[model samples]
Target chain A: MFDDKFLPQFEQIAGYIHDGGAVAIQQILHAGRYGGIDLGYCVQPSVVPQTLPHFRQPREVSKEQIKAMITQHAEAAKRAIKAGFDGTEITSFMGYLLANFNSKFTNRRTDEYGGSVENRGRFMRELIYAIKEAQGDDHPLIVRLNGAELMDAHGGNTEDECFELMKMAGDAGVDMISVTVGWQEAPESSIGRDIPPGHWNRLAVRAKQLLPNIPIAFGVRLPNPVMANQNIADGEFDYWEVCRPLLAEPELLHKAAEDRLDEAKHCLGCMNCLSRLFRDLPYLCTNNPTLGHEVEPEYHITPAVVKKKVMIIGAGPSGIECAIAATKRGHDVTIYEKSNSIGGSLVGYAAYDMANKEDLRSQISYYKTMLDKLGIKVNLNTDVNPKLMRSILHQYDVAVVAAGAGVDTRGLPIPEQEGVLVTAADVAGGKVKVGQKVVVLGGGKIGLTLAEGLSQTGREVTVVEKEKRIAGDVIPTWKWRHTSWVEQLKIKTLTLSKPIKIGASGVTIVNEKGEETFLQADTVIAASPRRPNQELFQEFEFMVDELHGIGDALVPRGLLQAIHEGYRLGVRI
Target chain B: MVSTADEMFLDTEGWQAILDRRQEIFTDMLPGASLGILPKKNFDSPVGTMLTWVRQADRMEVAYQSFTGFENTSVDLLMVVDDETLEYLHSQAQDNAFNEMKEQIRNGNVLLYVMKTLDELLDLGYEELIEVLKIPVLGACR
Candidate 1:
């Protein structure tokens, strides 16, 4: 973006996109407070220090620098147009450099570039004018502004002020406005799965109301294409700015067009993409196995040369995913589940999930739909044990042990009574009954999710973890949410503590400090220290011509690992 | 090791080191503005052991004194950091240390309170104080 040297590359990209019959718009963003990673200093209208350690310290931008920046933006826009881009977009979203100039919290300059909303927006106005002049009238320019900064606590722009800025952009002759929500430093959740889809439609509605003449595009946390279409028809916004949804399913729009959205995989809103970006890693999607490895030939489904019959054990995310993939590759595939339903441990996990249960449930629905469409056979309530494998002895050429992880209760203190101890899976799946007082062993995501869910129902629940901190196994992005939910739900947590003995009335626990405590619990649930169901691999090894283990069967982990392993196995097999 | 005109005795080297490393925080303060750093141990109280700055006739003076109670002086903001976090800051390189400190602030391990309102500052949670006070706490991960 700094030089025209990359114009050849831009031309290639623009040509490639145009060759696909799509218009290309190059988005030029300057990470203001979030910039200067290598230089150790960012440029802003005022000397505002960074709020996050991930960003650099700020240096005040003089009037001369501001003028130079405006010209630089204009030149960049010209370069983009010359390279064959149909349009250009300059964003102030997520507290970028343009946002730093516009925000009252960041822009403390005493000069004309700071102060009142009008003066604060002058930089944007000048940039728009210059870029429009440089790119000419034929090319459109889209300005992305925050509809809600969600930074009210820090004295950031109010919703009213955000709209006022929108009006300024509209008046400045911008062709369209893409309204976004929240800053990276915003304390609350914006796009995470905890936030329900269509939660931010009000912002779009307000923007549409404020600027009737201007085209408004918004898709913050709104992943469903059908809902987006309805919102557009309802006049909430002129266009739907889809992003992460497409990341999960690149054929999202195409599926919607063919009325096959039910077949399209939905974004779980897990924030794994942003989470990876924060860690300076490549973007990875939880639901999309082929997201980052698109170019890898092994990651994609290809017609199998042998057309072998594949037998997949346990109809969870892993097994189902492998079934669908193998079926697509022209292999005869069938899934065997001991449970009455197709979704394995996920069925139980989704039931107790606090954040957007539909998101997790949709994964199962997607699997079910894809399995049916792919003509894969699924035998529910059929356990694939050694006996079953022996009976089916040469029936299937390949046996896949996707029989996902289970709670390892072997380490749990022996219960005085027969039914005092139960697996977290039993409790989550509603197979076991719980009493008023419950103590959950292990403070990982499963234990926490169950503890929080039980506490919400007015059950007295306490989580005892052997580790010093809970959520050691949870993803970095979601660790905060679990902690917050536990606090808000008033669920008691005992870290650095482990259950020593279990009784019918209560459980005996010991802390790290050698202090013993008796916690009254009607049921002690073992939720962690899960061992993979690797028994199938050994059991089916001699029986089947080819036997392999994928997902938690290989090693216990979460949905991401399960799907990735499943797809990789399916593709290669 | 080095002497200045207004050197004063402080309780811990941590407090002195904090002031020495982050003195620009004081220079950006208004003449009347005062901020108090409250250790996590003594968070129940309204006041903390003082590491403050006073603007004199021409020069800004850095003072490290004992807690004098909230009513005795006008304090604009209160920043609370756990004793462990302060020790953590001392154990790392200057740049790496502040980055961790800023991250601690972001995580609410370091808490900030606007003294006048007695309300927890939510601008940047704990780290926003750096922005509000114009203190260039530096370091980038890249």
Candidate 2:
């Protein structure tokens, strides 16, 4: 309910809030033109996505205009205060205009609010003090501030800034500061990437070090409570702001309290929750269907009408989810996974990022729990063929296929030298060995992640993307790390470079100018691009009968698409 | 990721169909409308265009949409107002910040923005928002 489509809905809800509960108005001036992309998305991106070198909001903000914006902010606050909101959370994280004004990287103008750190922080500082005075101290004022965005491009903001802002807000009669990262253009990297688990803790610890008494909420992507509690145990952050995960599984807190954490089915950080933010789609979870369904429980979760027999084949995300839902509906269930372990491709992809892998494993545990609760039997390491399916067809009322797609390792058409090509899965599985000097041909997510790992391993790596920028489809936060891996590894990136030939010596490439050049490498990885081996056709009968096929089995795609299909199929079936 | 079609002419099942099929998705938005969806006539290729690298999408719920203060009939507008980054980046390729995006937009590799309201068009200081409807659709994979 954050877009234009929500305004009418807002008024209707605003009427209800006014009728009873209080409402707090949080307005973020996402300045898209300041530093990089001026991405209307990032409150204030490091580099405006659209660079207007000559255009600067600070320089353009005349005293009168500044007064106008401030007055507007105050008026909105005053209106909300009048509308019965207990207080407001001044959102500055994700580098909004106020946040950008605080960022030295984004603000570079010869104006009162653009030079020193104090000047850069003036807007957020002024707004807090102004609104605090307007609403009075102890009115429950909160500022969502960033300790760091984790992006190199967005000239990092640190715990020092958080501590400074805490004191300033205290002086200005502010109440709390919720700390977050990923404010810059590259979101995942803003806080932490999918690599190294609990990466944001260090930054959070730095903030707490400076402001011991102030409350700080950590906004990293946590798929489950174990990770959240672990972070709290580490004392890196004081509060855990469950936004996306909450969208993924709204019953998280309740489920955790009931000792049913696995049943909660954590968020995958696929960025779908925020996707709906663009169109007012309920912040959704690829696993949990009940999210954002406060009004209608039927749409999310339906209670069982009567116990029935159910059978599921191909135990990937979709298979597990189906088993869970069916068992919850009082049906006796059985699961068939071709792999030895219950987690299919996830077992391989689980190694992608520690935190993300943990999330995936946590969901896997949920499948185990739900299946066990419903007395669902699982036949592991047994492939489900048509004959086996027919033999059991009389025993089960419904059949679900989670059988995943085939793993496609399309070799490079170019000549291969020793140790030059590897499947993305093999790379993630740590099978691919990168030599001292490396060149990754494919620049997709796997290629990028693999490239990052190789670069982090301290190899001289060069990433040749057939496309312009690598990892274009990763979430903002992760996107940051994906690219940073390239920078942090000091990997040489050749965009708009096409690979014409590959050999043991290295790779032959034509740059954007179409000039042929050979990149010398000790080894070459041909993961430049690959396809999924969706097995939907094999499950055609199951889909026709029980109505679903999920994961790579159906589309032969990545986790994002696979998980989405799995969850949606859960509802349809 | 680039995909080729076979069953329905796609490497991945019609991702466009999957995306387009979300109209019935029950979510927070009561009547979720896909803004990036464009008329088939808008594209040179029937297949959807890919907007891989551009960043940040601003989701705005229009409080009001009017021309000279006269209101439009439909619910104001649910628009994803892109900052002039694409336009700005397209205009300045030589500049350091735009070196990456300039090549994409020029080559016609653009994710189209659906202009639902009159102000969305006017906000860009352009004559017609309706005309820009002939662009690529804006969306996310998951």
Candidate 3:
């Protein structure tokens, strides 16, 4: 319904909001990367170039430029008013253009637009005036802001200044204000990666205390509806802006109303959707494949396509999704699992706490339910190849390549004592035994998760990262959570350090200062951080009439990316 | 003197000529209007620039410049020329627009796609600029 509608389009949605008098938030879309980063549409950038002035790199506006932008916002508001929007929100949330201006790291200017807090909010101040002028003085104009900067360079922790800015927004005619921590520069850190649940929720409490008269809200990816309700009960926050979770499931609001709490599709704190956003690709969910492709005819499949014969190979998440997708298309999809049962590598992953296991469990459940609905055949104890799988190609019109990864134990060329070394997969599968102490080699997501699991098991663990930071490739949000938990569990993470050698007694590592220290470890897990599973992929390399590859077959990364690529390829067909 | 970065060359005059050539190529496609033509007057300057509303199938205006070898067509067109003939002409434009705008994004020139449009709008001449701009919206007609 909100198609190509400009700022004034809010009025249409506002009708529903106003009937209930629900708040009208101006969810401003800011390209934190601006034109530099490919936002959803490449054509928008092409619409106006930088020389066109409007196409300017959303740079920290000069007092003059800021005034002009504020005027445009005011004009947008005036149009919205004409369109019947009840109130105006000069959007500052979700790391939009204004947030970029607010960013301490990205905004390096020494002028009034940058530096100290008062000077920093110069642009925002002008914008509030524009909104006030547009609203004719008596409508709510709220400011969405960061309670903290997730990155170090941007000064998000200027608590007193944040308080001062809240006060300024209130006094300058801002009707309400909401505070969320983490900047768009590092959005992963903003949602839940760097901070704990209700992390920035407390910031709103502080802001509310500072400006007691004005209402304040906090944003987080809280999957637990009960916790959200309880936090409101506990007076910790005013309102919650559920971004990622809502992206994970848009029906969340209506479903919770029916008290069908378990039915609510939760956000896994995975950033697949946002990562796709960086490349202007479609949104992907760990569980739902219907997101972003809502416009397609087969967006939500009907019973008509439920009768065709379909074959899905490999029991991995991608293969499962393909089978599920094929089944939903009204095809009688049959899943071939090489292993005894379903839930490939995900079995080891789902063995973790529900949050870590949420995606895997829910998706497996979804596929199982779908397969049940269609009466599709699932054959376990089945391995497939070019010759053996030839019958499947002849049988089903479509074949999916979802064979889970082959064991890749590429480790350091350095030697290790017998029984002292165990790959992460072996440990994950519980086939290899670890002694009282352990040293994990790789710091990738898999390696890190394994280390965290070991630490939770009360094993003494030391993680040595060759890089300066342990979780660079991991989404900022997950990195923040995992890193914080690992720290709390007292897992020793040695950054900028390399394992010198591993002996039966322990492992020796050279620190950044070139100082060699031997840590006591009965076992060393060689999670050599993985490369693509070539052996499995090579088996089907040009054997079939049609072939497509995705997931770790592309690269060994987090489940989020694999989920995104899988969902994208699903809708493509 | 608007030079491209490093050994990257920028011939502003040549670019001006290439742009001028494109304007000629698409002259008939442009809107046309009458203007106070001060013969051989300055064109490079933003001031000598004037936009007039007019009536014509194609927008038209002509001028000569000191920095330009001949004149310009459009910056947007230069970044995405229709043919090798256009490329040769663009290369002749001394590739000044390359730094300001490019046919492609390599380093960090996502702006080229639209920057070229700006150059086209300017090279579109001033006489018929307003006529083209008066986009008759259905609602606005009321």
Candidate 4:
């Protein structure tokens, strides 16, 4: 229905885009039961109640209405050919119009287009036949199908049924099968950080087995290019479909071809892109902030018109980002880190957790490789004091203070407390010793990570927090993962319990309900809040002509915020 | 236990040993089965922390269900360790919409367990826990 007005816009887009030798294909879909929810009405095979509250219930489609919709899809395909597209991909996945018609859960009608496998796939078959007829047999015609709806509980198609439907589409003369996973109504997380690399390639392999002649394209949470290549090599699928990974790193293929895999920015599988799409906003990447603004000239890092000497203090993510961006802009850059490693906090945090360590290490290795390639000067174990700041100001045109934050160790006041208190930073840095029975104060992200890390070592770990919840600052999509990990490790956490005193053998905790208890601990670690380290910035602000404070030195925040701040400063300077 | 000024901390080598131990434990537990841990609340309790570690290890198939909310039912097994979680499940069983769960429980297809405390749960060990829970119980479901 909306294709009538979008024809010219499609033509304009086709004319402007020129990716060398890459065939442009237009994808068309009818929201079907999922369509026009904002308008409060949609036409489907049957009236299926909306699972999510935000969506509106669709009106049942009569036979005549079905015939009209089929004609409309063919017309849309014709329009796409007119718009200079080489082919059109009809989407019958993710509870779209055709998918809803194909689903037994939604298609309860007893007419020619319902019930049995052949009947359930009748609408898709008709649509595909019409599209093939509209454009010649040689014209590229792809059909996107859910290899498995993953919605059996919702009365959706099983893997075998999906295979049958794909065969039906193949019989209907669809040139290619783009295999995807799950539906909108599927209860599980089909594609997220929780799903391992190359986990869903079996679905594609199954589709390939059924549709042997047709080329199969598959992608769902497959971010590792090496793993994707292996899957392709093993004949899982003919083509590796990628979208979000490109958003994370546009030069992914180019990097893979050049054997620069380490330099390639990999997708973290954080689901920020998916989240933005669900929110009806443009897709954005957490690792790469310049993703949605590819067309903007300012977002692209070009050679600086007037290059200057840039000195960055602290080799954390923020400082490293600034150094890289500045160096890319043809500026002389030097980074001074008090620690030996390039990744300040990440080195510690990543080293503590086994599951996410490799991904985090990959990110750090990429930055270190880039720094080496750019020939950026890096001085390790160099503390920047008042005298060092004075000397740095004299040498560089601009000085960026990214000294990072310090852990808060000023624990609770008690009369007879004599137990040792160590900061979370010390624990993460692998500096402080923790006994078999340990108690961590503060149930935030740092506290939880430390507690989990210690508990995994077969230590009796307990986390005490004044707040009611742990990892409260974690992203919504990743919160379940943290919660699940804590539960599995059996790390005891007492919430709404304040640390009263730290004694030689235990800590006295008082709950909000005025209940007092003593938790025995051989070691006590303070995972409290962090304060900004800005003393050097304050001292150097008046000494340097161009002085900037970024990252934790300016304000203690997460990695995304720090990188964004560093990037903003890099391009501006 | 030691004095505040005289306490000792593990150095980088000591921390690495801990990491190695964790990795060894995780690797030794495969090929793992899916285990669901349902908690009464959405807080940083022992259950939550354990679930987080299991997920992070990537060796085991684990699911966490918060008693306050129900999101998905894809897990192969369900663990209820607290009264609040069991009560929530009972309430869901009363609802007609949760007929699948009720049927699974009735037919001994769902692995249901109600433990007393975190220590009792951990003492069973990962292998023993899976062996005990994965076995289809007859009368425990009711």
Candidate 5:
């Protein structure tokens, strides 16, 4: 914005957007406290030291610099208009520079820019006025403000203060108000999957009520277009401001428009994308494997050079995903599962998941719909093995082992006992029953999830782990949730401990201190030490021309790797 | 007034002093603003050593409870420490203690916070505190 030399680049971008017949709004983002990524210091309204160590040290912006910043913003808006943009937007969301001025947590100015709510909001109001004036009335200007900063503990803006800022924006004659939620350093989750969809609709409703004349756009945690459309009909907000959901499935709107939403890949709200972005890596989605590979020729599904009969073992997320992708590429795909249903370990896990189970179940739903629409044959209750493959030896040109991993019963301390010991999978799959007192071995995500769910159901559950901490295998985003649920549900966790013996009455556990304690348990469940089902690789080595292993069958891992490996294998095959 | 983070948190007397000074703020807050502190001997291992402070009308009642892990305890806030942080506080190294505590807070071990206003504490619900306070109860995806 300081130089006109970048005008050609903006022009090219705007031209590309215009060619698509889409109205492009140039968002001049000044990531205030979060800026100066490569520099030693970031400029904030006040010198508030960073709560998150990832951010740079803050340097207070001078009054003179504040004036220059406003001028720069105005000039940026003008340059955007010159570049053929339909409108311009200024963002104060996510504790940015504008947010720094508005939030009491950062703004400590004693001059005209601080003290009262009106004074704190003066910067945003002025920026809105200046950008509107610079871009002219013909071009609309949108201001993105936080409906709730979720920073009250740190003396950040209250809900009323946030509403006051929105009101200020509306009174200043801004075209639209894009209400967002939470700051980067905020302790609570605003958009995570644990938060139910439509949880923040009340914020949107309040924003609309406060500013009836200004168009309000909001989509914080509200993912489904069907829900967004209903919210619009109910007057929750004027437009559904979506970004991450589109990142998960770029054709989300098109699928919604075509009424083929069941086929649309839903954003799981796993935060893998944001997690990567926070760590300075390229964005990747857990469910949508081709998210960052838009331009890669290998990622796109092209018609197979030679259509082959592809047999995928295990109708889990991995196998189902492969079946769908391969079928789309003109291959005759069929999925074989040992269970009565399609979803493998995921179905079991989702049943006990403390987080949004619907999001996990939605992936399975999408896969089922795609498989049906593509006419992919699914043979459930058919376990693929050497004997089974011999019957159909020449049936499939390629054999994909997506059979997934299972608990290593061999690693358990106690030998299996009827009605006394059950696998976590069996317990989750409802194939095996449990007693009143339950002892779960291995305190990773799987163990903790099972324990939490059982405890919720009034079963006295205890988790035993050899590690120093639980949730070691859980993703960083949901680690705290697991820990919290375990605490809230009063689930007992014995970290740095492992079960030594299992009996009819209970299990004996040994702690790190070389002391043994007896924890009475009616059932001891094994939930850890997952081993890949790689025996088929050796058995079917001479059976098929191509015997490839994917997902948990290759290595015991999580959903992201399983989906990615499946899709990648499907495209190449 | 205590001079440093170490001086303020090293002994029971220091904690009692803090509670006394901040009595008005604590008393004004809603009940159940109890804070739990778990100091681990090492970061990688679990150590059973715990401290709790419950807010009262006049002062905060500080006590040492049986070292139960966070799951069995109910508190508005909890602070868990790493080995180095505990060493710094024990050694009475003021600057080192403060800096290490800040780093630990970022690392999700120390859940240190300073509530500014009574309204802020009163208005925030239990779930909101779990979500918004940097208490490190760990749940957020994107």
Candidate 6:
């Protein structure tokens, strides 16, 4: 609810973002039973208690209270118009006030605003009509409603009932309909990467069939623009409602339009943004570092005052990102890759899963396309050492060392068992032959991912970790998916286990409480404790005037840090 | 580094051709609308001098300025320098630039046109620009 007290803040935002051409829209909502418990009381259509412990129970609202609620919605819409917004959208999803009234799960009132589909939808209908009357019918109003509550067993509305509610809202003079799925209490992952792109299009298609005249904005785990366009072209939905994808890559539409779909940083479907929002923190993209700092001038890419010839060693994510950013700043960049191809760890990791492989491969393809387009010279199979660097000393003004990491077997105290033990990198890289019963030495992300991949190939995989948990290094948002995959694949994970000796036949492990066990394995793959390869960078530190170290060359970290470091260095240099 | 047409470092004629192509596209697409062409500042290159020549060229209400940064001002259309310039435009556009321009276009205020090179503009004809403009301006404002 907006009032004159909030006008100053709204005006300040409007003025601050007044880049001379903006159509700011205000969204109004009432939490009802979902309102803060600290407020002392909450009102709902009926006396419904929240399943979650943190949420408070709400008292039933009387008929007079319902009239007051409708009046409040109308007043909020009028305030939004006065606050300089082009229009206002009434939020009736995600277990909000209006959504609670419309949902059969929360609404048990025998009054006109409850019971049948029409009665359950009456509150929303009245709210929309009241808002339109308070402002004007031509005020570009929109109604945001859930296509499916995803709470089928919890007395939520069905797809048919939701479509009927949409028709009701459309008939009430809403300019457009925004379709979303799931609620706060839904027992499903609706917007995660696990859900394939355009998975919720059937909901939108049904809405279009029901309300053919009203425009539909479809969203809920749809990230691909190609698929979005195809759906629109096929008339499944009028608008592809994108939010998280835009957060991941701000220039998604622009890059798609320029035929640089690969160049566009696709949303990895890592729910880091959603995770942050759930914790009441500002959302950030795992891949794009400039996401939340849009207003900062430092994040804004500006043309370099002076262009220099830059030499980046290694063709990993960090190296490629540095090359791209530096080249974009008009610098002449040449990447010297020790391997024959690009995407150092990414190339190996892409082979771990079918869906993930496609996503990572697209990114690698984008890097290749961008490198080609920017005229960046990539020297493959050309490892840069001191002697080789001295030969090309005059060629580059600045040198960036991103030589990446090396596998260290120190974590596993097993004796050197030649020809029996292999690194997880080797197994993931498909360089080494894996046996039928393979024991992965570590339970980090690499180990778990490799285990999942190995299990897919019908190999009996066992991950032994000295630590208590597996995939500890994985991003929190994606940890569940990895754990679920490991579970589904039936990959055995032995925690609190230490390798004592590595024989030709199997490895001897000492578990907690002084228990010793022989985990028979045909082959052991070491996946943990990677040390940084800072030799080249350290050797050339004094030789060049401008020398920098980034990515795994500085320290063995994940892709988020590597890419961010590359981008930071690229912009700074 | 590998050499390409864009990396060749545009001379006076090359820059003039880019300016001419932009003027033609903007003039044709927005017909009788004021245009502002902002080229990235290259102190060591001849583009700065070439922009001076372009500013003096006989074009209808075309405002030319060399800026190292971005700013929003009064203009019917905005013409940028190169891919780097467009990349900057894309970065800013992420911060509600396109949405704002879409609103402006709907209200007959402004239009944003990005050209990587003179040839790219020529390759993307007026019809294509209209089609591209229609999406952000009319279709996908949200």
Residue A555, model 4, lDDT = 80
Q: Choose the strongest candidate by DockQ.
A: 5
- Could you tell me which 10 consecutive residues in candidate 5 chain A have the lowest summed lDDT? A48-57
The weakest ten consecutive residues by lDDT in model 4 chain A span A48-57
Put down candidate 5 lDDT per residue, A99-127, tens digits, no spaces.
Answer: 99999988987899998999999998889
Q: Each model's DockQ?
A: 0.05, 0.04, 0.05, 0.02, 0.09, 0.01
Q: What share of the true interface contacts does each candidate keep?
A: 0.00, 0.04, 0.10, 0.00, 0.14, 0.00
Candidate number that wins on lDDT, 1 or 4: 1
TM-score on alpha carbons, each prediction: 0.84, 0.61, 0.58, 0.77, 0.83, 0.74
Q: Residue-wise lDDT of candidate 6 within A536-564, one digit each (tens)?
A: 76789877778898988898878877888
User: Total clashes, candidate 3?
Assistant: 29
The positional error of residue A57 in candidate 1, measured at the CA in angstroms, is: 1.7
Count residue pairs with overlapping backbones in model 4.
25
Q: A187-231, model 1: which lDDT tens digit per residue?
A: 678888898889999999999998999999999999999999999
lDDT of 1: 0.80
The i-RMS of candidate 4 is: 15.1
For candidate 2, lDDT tens digit of each residue in B1-142? 3321112212122333332233222122222222232112222233432221111132212121222110111221222212343334323323432223323332333332222322343343222122122111122221
Model 2, span A299-335: residue lDDT tens: 5446566555767777777677767666665567778
Q: Chain B, model 5, TM-score against the native? A: 0.52
Query: Between candidates 1 and 4, which one is better according to TM-score?
Result: 1
Model 2 chain B — which ten-residue stretch has the worst lDDT? B62-71
Clashing pairs in 6: A21-B100
The predicted structure with the larger TM-score, 2 or 4, is 4
Candidate 4 per-residue lDDT, tens place, A1-573, comes to: 246688788887666543444677888888885577467667788765554323454678889888888788788888888887888898988788888988897788788999998898998988888888887676789999988887675568888898889888888888999999877655456777657777788889888888789999998778888888988899999988888788888889889989988888877676767655654567778678687777787777888998898889999888988888888999999999998789888777777663556767777998889899889999999998888776655788888988888776655645254547777778888787789999998877677777888888999999998876777676545554566577679888898898887888878999999999999988888877777788876688777679898887788767776777787788778
